[model samples]
Structure formats: C-alpha cells, structure tokens
Target: MAEHKTNAMRLLDKAGIRYRVWNYDPGDGNIHGTAVAAKIGKPPETVFKTLVAHQGASLFVYVIPVGSELDLKQAAKAAGAKKIEMLPVKDLLKHTGYIRGGCSPVGMKKLYPTYIDDSAMKLETILVSAGKIGLQVELEPASLAAQVSAKYAPLAKRGAGEAASN
Candidate 1:
C-alpha cells in the first residue's frame, strides 16, 4: 500500500498548488461523508467525495459533492463508453491503493478520467479527500483538474430536492 502521504498529497505539493488540510472526526468511518462537510463548515454541495468507476476496460473517477450520488449513466455518456459502473472494492484497492473511505482525485496508481461535479465549480474553494480518513485538502476545482490532469466533466446531479447547478 502507499504511505501516509499518498501520491495525491505529493502531487499537490510538488505542483506548489495551495491547499488547506482539514482534520475532522470520522465517527465509526461513516463520518468521512456528511460529517466532513459539517466539519469544514461548508455546505455538503461544496464538499466533494471521490468515487472510482469503470468505462469499458479503463478506470474512471468521479469527484462530486456529498449532496449527490454518482449517476452512472451520465458518467458512461461522458466517458463515451457503452457502460460504466462502480469498480468493486478489490479493484478500487488495486487501482488506487487507498481504501474506500480515503480516496483522492488528485493521485492514483494510474491516470483515470476525472469528472468534477458541476457543484464544485460553484464554490471558490472545494474540499476533497486527501488520501486518508480524517484528512482533507481544499483547492480550486480548476487547479485540481489541471494539476492532476483530470478531464473535467459533470458526473452527478443535485439530489431530488436541491437546485440544478449541482
């Protein structure tokens, strides 16, 4: 497995990209989700989570705000793959070397197509998982995509009650 400072963190620092590291209470592991949004004092829509998926034989990732779920159909369409689905835990581990709770969009074992949900673009700064539980880093969506070589795309929509921007 990767070390404490994951390839993600190293990439950020190497690029001299500015980001703030936030630590929060990960209560029984589930807290990395909504609890992280609250801990950072940001709306759930401004705090994003990293999800790994597959497009044909290739791996893809979606970085979306916590308020929404991964729309697999949208993701597949964006990737131009006939089908797309969540990568199994074993595949996720093999691909990113990070457990499900601490996946980061910045660094991975290989370069996967990265989709940053539209919701994140609404915020001047967004929080993303920092390759470990209880750790997060804040940066602009554009910077994350550029520094990480991500392919910007919309992979999710705001949950039923929220507005359309997400």
Candidate 2:
C-alpha cells in the first residue's frame, strides 16, 4: 500500500531530507507514546512526542521521548521564560493547527521556538509524529533539529513511578 503524505512529510521532502515513515494500527484506540513505541517496535526513548507550552503570548514547542514527561521547570529555563504551562488540548488545534496525538513540531501554523530533549541527540535517529495519528517519521536527530530550528536541551523527566530511560 502507498503511504499517505502529511504536511510534515511534504516539508521534509521539499528540503531534500531523507526520512522513513512508520505506520501502525490506531484501531485499538490507544495512541499513547509507549503504545506507539510498542507498535512501531522501537524503544520508548527513540520515539518522541511533540508538546506545546505557552508563557503569556509566547508559545514554545518541545519534542521529548514519549515515556518521559516534560520537566516544566527545565522547560521554562530552556526557553528563558519565567513560567511555562502546557497548552490546553482544547486550544491545541487553534494554536498549532494539530489535534492531540497528531501534532508534529514541523509544519505548524507558525514557527514557534522549538526545543528537543538532549536525549534525542544521543540517538542517531528518533521517531516523531508525522503530522498525523498512527504515523511517524524517523530521521536523523540533527536533521530534525535543523529542519525546525530547534535547540537540544534537558527538557524531559521520567514521570513519578516511571522507569528511567537514561
């Protein structure tokens, strides 16, 4: 079957960046990061998720491993903001033009400052949402950062009771 192209994929193609698309079944109604990693047969640390946060009128994007939670304090420090809070799911599409579980740092309605967890830089390649649910795009970490003008920083923390992936 032919793979469907997403806005993120098209953007990568236009930049001549090479990427591999991974598709998994969304039928079970489980799209959690860990579930996605399992379906894609990759380590949880290698599968990243996009999250949006805001401070006043400023918006920031973060890409971190699915199994890890965003460390709000670290995120705020990285962005040089006094405080940062997750963007509400109800306003996600309006703010970033992406619905929950399908947001990609790339191809957003506008280019907001983007930051990726330094953990991603440790891997040669990382998988992130391909602008749609059930789809992911695997590419070089450096390439992903360059594509989105993102910086790598310590922005992820294992959630309470979660195993450390470090």
Best of the candidates, TM-score = 2
Index of the highest-lDDT prediction? 2
Query: lDDT, candidate 1, residue 25?
Result: 69
Each candidate's TM vs. the true structure?
0.88, 0.93
Question: Model 2 Cα displacement at 1 (Å)?
Answer: 7.7
- Which pairs of residues have clashing backbones in candidate 1? none
Per-residue alpha-carbon lDDT of candidate 1 for residues 1-166, written as tens digits (9 for 90 to 100): 1236656778998998888887776878867577788876878877889998886578888888786788888888877788888899877878887888889888788778777776666679888989888888888888998876667567776556865543
lDDT of 1 at 43: 80
Error of 2 at 42 (Å): 0.4
Worst 10 residues of 2 by lDDT: 157-166
